[model samples]
Target: MNRAERPPATLTELLSRHDCDQALLAALRERRLPELHFYQSGPSVRAWTELCSSSAYRGYARSFALVDAHAQTIASALPDRPIEVVSLGAGDGAKDLRLLRALASTGRRPRYTAIDASYPLLAGACAAAIESGYPARGIRADLLRDAHCREAGRMLDRQRARLCLLLGGNIGAWDPGDTLRLLRRLTEDQDYLLIDAHQFSERDTLPQYDNPTNRRFALAPLRALGLDDSAGDVHFRLGTSATVPGLALVEKCFEFVETSTVSVGGARFAFRRGDSIRMSSSGKFQGHAFALFLESAGFRIRHQFGGQAGGQVLLLAQRRGAGG
Candidate 1:
């Protein structure tokens, strides 16, 4: 791509063009629950990086096994040409690099682009790829915004083909309708979208979110925003997705036990007792429900990798009407 037309090459430029910094600053200035997504801040990004890398997290290493096992299959499904590997919400780029390595094992070396709003995480991703001698770049763009999505498209359009990764159930955090809309924005015909989701079940769902590691990961931004555990407690509850029946959701909430005040960006907001702020929610999908969702969103599933044990899953899908 021409330098003039290319998406912002650095975090500073991306932040300036997208006003992500300004929006978060404004949210903090107004003392409202930050409209910022969970991965927008440095501390939260670090917390997530740690959580994902920690040995205590199940499949911290095993998650890459799926990529290794399906490497050749994924490579075969793509157009028999050089491709760009674009990872959305790529925290630390751990799983992405594994996928890239697997592709390389299949005799394809793809240029990697890590798309995320967190500058710290984005820099780390690019740095790791470069250190490993892979051609790579980082775009600090918020995935939820349409403008950023367009910028990502421009970055990928320069390649012969594109493989998009939405690993670790990243899409599950949004409302089902918004998730489909986001997917639509992020992909074009013949492009590949690899997304993962936790299998949903009535049992063994809530415990995943109720743990300390997750509480810390989910509350990192709150603490960085200057709220302490004393001000509120982080909790999780199970809910059902109204738009997608049979889809389960884990809602992360911060509920204040007593009246308190939080100050950020020189602004202060008072919270009444018993008030709650929703931090984030993740969707859990049954295998059939996930396939139905992809089909509904105009994607044809090319391959579904991972065991059927009702946990993490990776689905490789192509925009309909094309073989790639």
Candidate 2:
């Protein structure tokens, strides 16, 4: 259709003409920010960085360093061939560097790819790999989208074996079923999947998300919706899945103190005084439960590593019957 003779189009269609973010718009319509969206902008990235540095949340990252202790074992488990590392949700590329260094020590140079939805985070991940003198590149991808996942798979060098890294106990950040489907998409018959999960113990995890820095990060979406601190209260509580028995998650949400409504793009969305909207949640698998979960989801667990009194775990997995 000719531009002058076209029918009326919605703002989204117009925005599309200028390349606006479809995912952000879709989430904004719900007045909530899912975990992936939390890192898309610089402000959110800085907020996450602040939370990660705080005493409350910083300790969890130390657990990921366990990969260093298990690197040689991980290398020995893999096939004796060139391996390219693909890091999903590769924020800052810190953890992948540990794995890459392990591969490098095997008398071979390793290639790395950091895929993320955030340009700022993607740039940092790519830069870290380049600075370490390893060949690397960043692919801008929304991990939640199947098309994006398939596109990323296409970019890999097909001849070499692939070791997919989904570290930082990230398995908790997504729904268990969703996570399983995602892993299947990211791996192939000969590929390796390195994933980790933090156990949701009331003692260690509860206080971490309830602290000041994390509170700020959780309230950001509500604040953007034009709600002030006085408009509601923030709470961190543990939730469980009805279907999956061992599954548990710590949820961060904002409860409205009074009835309120918001207007965006001429759409009025209502909120009750007691209603709440989630900011984020991480699925915490207890002990060998994570390993069992992977097997149930059709992934074959090859090697397992952990520390912090069994509160954390890293599993090297592959598709069922994928072993050479």
The candidate maximizing TM-score is 1
Per candidate, the number of residue pairs that clash is 0, 2
Predicted candidate 1 versus true structure: per-residue lDDT over 1-324, tens digit per residue: 344444333443355424754576555444334323567677777777677766545534445667667767777788767788888878788778777776776667778888877777778887776666567888877667777777676656565688988877776776667667667787778789888777875666677667788778878877876778888888888888888966888877788888877654565667777987765577888657887888788898988877364566778998886553
What TM-score goes with each of the models? 0.87, 0.85
Error of 1 at 127 (Å): 1.2
Q: Which pairs clash in model 2? A: 172-282, 172-283
Candidate whose lDDT is highest: 2
For model 2, how does the per-residue alpha-carbon lDDT over 1-324 read when each residue is reduced to its tens digit? 343443231110111211224554566567555777677556778887887677778545665566778888887788778888989888888878888888888854678888877777877887777777677888776666677677777778888888998887677777777776777777887578888778667678788777888888776645655667787888888888765667787877778888877544445567788877766577777656778888877778888776343367888898765343
Q: Stretches of candidate 2 above 4 Å error?
A: 1-21, 221-227, 258-272, 307-310, 322-324
